[model samples]
Target: MAHCALEVADVFRSLGPGWHQSVNLSLGQLKVVSAIEQCRSAALGGHVLRCEGCAAIEVAYNSCRNRHCPKCQAAAARRWLEARQADLLPVEYYHVVFTLPAAISEIAYYNKAVIYGLLFDMAAETLRTIAADPKHLGAQIGATLVLHTWGSALTHHPHVHGIVPGGGLSPDRSRWVACRPGFFLPVRVLSRLFRRRFLEELEAVYHRGQLQFFGEHTELIDPGVFAKWLAPMRACEWVVYAKRPFAGPEAVLAYLSRYTHRVAISNQRLISLDERGVTFRWKDYRVDGRTRNKTMTLAANEFVRRFLLHVLPAGFHRIRHYGVLANPSRRENLSKIRALLHVALEAVDPDGDVSSCAAQPSFVCRHCGSPMIIIDMLQRSRPIRAPPPEQCHA
Candidate 1:
């Protein structure tokens, strides 16, 4: 299995000098670069694991456990789903995506931690409020929202993916009100309400001096400039795409694995990362049914720049809950939802087969030629580590 870091390294080495030395480098991005370099498998602990296909033995190291680290996304993904298991309702769920326009991407990059936060809150609130309307489901809806910051080409495209139950409890909390079998809320109405609530909140944030613009957007500090800039977005059709409601709990889990804890890109998509720049596969949305995993090469510096664009703010969480999933009432709400739907309550790892889940491949130590079991798992208690160039031996 080729790791994203290794592929990054192949690109990282080819960049001209002063790649990481530029003054424009944000403090947030510098941390990601440092974290990724220190994540070489040799440092964390594997020795050498031989491949069955050939006599090849690779050295492996443990991941840095950072959310942004591609290697660590899987572990975090599993843990997130485990916690969310307690929040799953018995009814079918829907996957709703809310996309911001390109005009907003620059502002979003400047205030990612704030505007994105507002985006999630306002969007979730809008869905719940509208669904509770008598004309709609007329009940409280529960949802799980996760933020995605990168597009297929690694550009800054901030969007929110919502995993929402199709229906919810009425005001009386006495009975279940299932939504239309194939639908949840009207996308047309959700778009309008979402647009209004989001813009209203954005204006409040701007007025309180919470927003800032830099780089090419420095002039946006003026009030009139921002108002005019925002005007075009209102008429620009705020994108809201709703997929078919999920079939059942099993399908929900499958969807969670794909959406939750997903990094900008995955290792499986990478084909080669040698001297010919960097090459990887991606599903192009414009091409329709035709699928291609073609590899494209890019200069190392440009590649790293693109990858680093997605490094989130420190301590910022991408996944959040609303309504029934909120921490204060999640457990009780889950029980009630289960009762109303007459479905048996289930656990995250219902079968207690977590360990039996697929195990990652480990490298055998070069000296001992034995499978190197992890002797110590590094935690927050461990001292901070500097960058490691070559493989750090176990």
Candidate 2:
């Protein structure tokens, strides 16, 4: 049998050094280096267990399971969506995207900690504000916003994808105003508002000197940089498209499961890792090749370089809430919305819920309120002993 090491440690043993080199090579790419290194070994230990059929013994160390760690996000995404089941409403939900102007994104990457954070807040607020406008829906809506930094080509494009219910409660919070059956919010109007709100927030952050620019981006620190950067986007058509709303709740959960804990890439996508450089699959988005896996072979150095480009600043949030979903109002607003939408009773059975949906994780230690989570797990195989009970005399 072609047996490979079962634990993440083995993968890191072969790959960690290259990642470290990839980081030191570029100041710009250093963001994800530590994240990858931390994910390489099993710092969190686990007891050994024996396999039933093969009775093979191997170490199955724990995983860092960081959302950014490709090794960990899949299970996380599923869990997040699972919990969402109880929160979902029985209405069509729309997928709305809010994109930052290219003029700003260049600087945004350097100041990702601030600018991207602002983008999420602004985007979510815009959605909430607009939906609450007596002109739009009048009902305060709920949204799940997720941040993504890369475009299909691996370029640093900051954007937020919002999954929102079709309609919201009337201003009085008594009547349920169903959204246009097919359309949620008008895409064009939402896009423009999103652009303006984002730019305004960007300016606020800039004026406060909260934004940082390093190396070639140092020029952007000047007000002139802000003005020059803001001009093009002021007129640019910000893309806030409404995809076909989900056919139902099942579809909604399925859609979000792929994105909630997404990392730059996953391990299964890697085809080969030998001296032939690193061959992996990437989507050719220009041609809608997202579903079809196209193999990309890059020099080991280049591969590491691309992989490290996505690391976010430590403690930055890639997922966020707005409007009724914001922390202060989440519980109360959810209760009201549930009553209004007549979905207070989750249709799915409790037992069935666990197997089907994944919840957004808090990473809490349970013992403490801090953002605590398992960083890694290390598992070792146990030796299988013969059944001696039958001949205890030995």
Candidate 3:
């Protein structure tokens, strides 16, 4: 793919220092700003490469490898997909989404770790509960859920995207029980259960004094007010819907490759940064067709603020697997399921040799198709100097 002329790093490099002076940002958010600014720049040193075929030399800079960095996710996604490739079954797969209501999302902005963890748990539980019912699929299903905290316009809209197989193993583990050819579980049922479980947990967390309220939400610190505030969400419909099943395993892998490691926005979507503001393209899902694609510009400060809204709590796992695919027993479970389905176990490379592939260089010559060998190491540069303590505090 062609490199984007504009990138999030460019926006951060231009406005981040000034924004930092004006805003009181968390340590995590501040690190994100600094990392993006220096990503793939000389600040993080990288090795020099020389092409075997063309004898061309190139200097490559190291990526920050921050999960939130758009430039860093491609390799991360590639590595993740390779690991998951063996987990794919021949069965059809479905895409489901469970979204927190706007009111809850507002609370989530302050309690991201607690609320986002609840979202993942409840979504996974809802799927398992509904799927195991004798009346529904009546089987144990596995699902991979990915958390996306941003809307197209960089708004705080928290949702979990679920990739689930259309079927599961029988209670006794004797047979593979598949859902109806086209349908997975009922969305209405899943949504109601998810809403109930999430609210119950939220209330519990509130009682434990784990939730914090600020600004207009300060009144919610009172139990009565918090209950009243949650009243509307109890009756409102939480968005949970499942799309049609993927065409096949290949299509499912393709979908995972795109959604699994995505950041809030890609560099490709950035249009330009100029006197007007930072302009970028975004999709309005509420609309249909070409009209949904539109550009919006925000003052650099506001843009940075919106972008940081999704930094997430430190050490949070945004991607999770549940049910049969649960990490503890995934390999054994996959082995059993493949046997039950009469499918062959995932094959190793023919001749059982991988050293050849491993020996290949990661980069190639731009002009000639030949492996580029690392000719020399580049030590990391000293970190950019920070302002003096008095000046920083000022």
Candidate 3 lDDT tens digits, 1-394: 2578999988877774566766767767777877888888888899899999999999998988889999999989977777787788989999999999999899899899999999999999999999999999999999999999999989999999999999998999999999999999998999999999999999999999999998999999999999999999899999999999999999998999999999999998899999888999998877644448899999877888899999988899999999999998787888899998889955545332322345556997888979899999898885533333443432
Query: Local distance difference test, per candidate?
Result: 0.73, 0.67, 0.88
Model 3 lDDT, full chain set = 0.88
Which run of 10 residues does model 2 get worst, by summed lDDT? 385-394
- List the RMSD of every prediction in angstroms: 5.9, 11.3, 2.7
Q: Which of candidates 1 and 3 reaches a greater lDDT? A: 3
Off by over 4 Å in 3: 16-18, 288-291, 349-360, 383-394
Rank candidates by lDDT, best first.
3, 1, 2
Model 1, 1-394: lDDT tens per residue? 3434444544554664345664356666665655655565454443444545445545455567777767677777876666555566667789999987887777888798888888789878988899889998899878889999998767788999999988888889998888988888889999998888888888899999999898788877999988888887777689888999888877898889888888887655556666656677665665766765555666556667778788888788788889877767877887787888788854335433344343544444455554445433433323234224222221
Instruction: Give TM per candidate.
Output: 0.83, 0.78, 0.94
Best-to-worst ranking by TM-score: 3, 1, 2
Tens digits of per-residue lDDT for model 2 on 1-394?
Answer: 1222232223444564444442343332332344344453454444343443344344444555555667667667766666677767778988988887776788876688888888888777778787888777777777889998886545677888888888876777787788878878777778778878878887888899898777777777789866896788788787778898898998888888888777666665666767776666677655653465478876666665565567777677788777666767666777787776666464555433554333433343323333333434455233222222332221
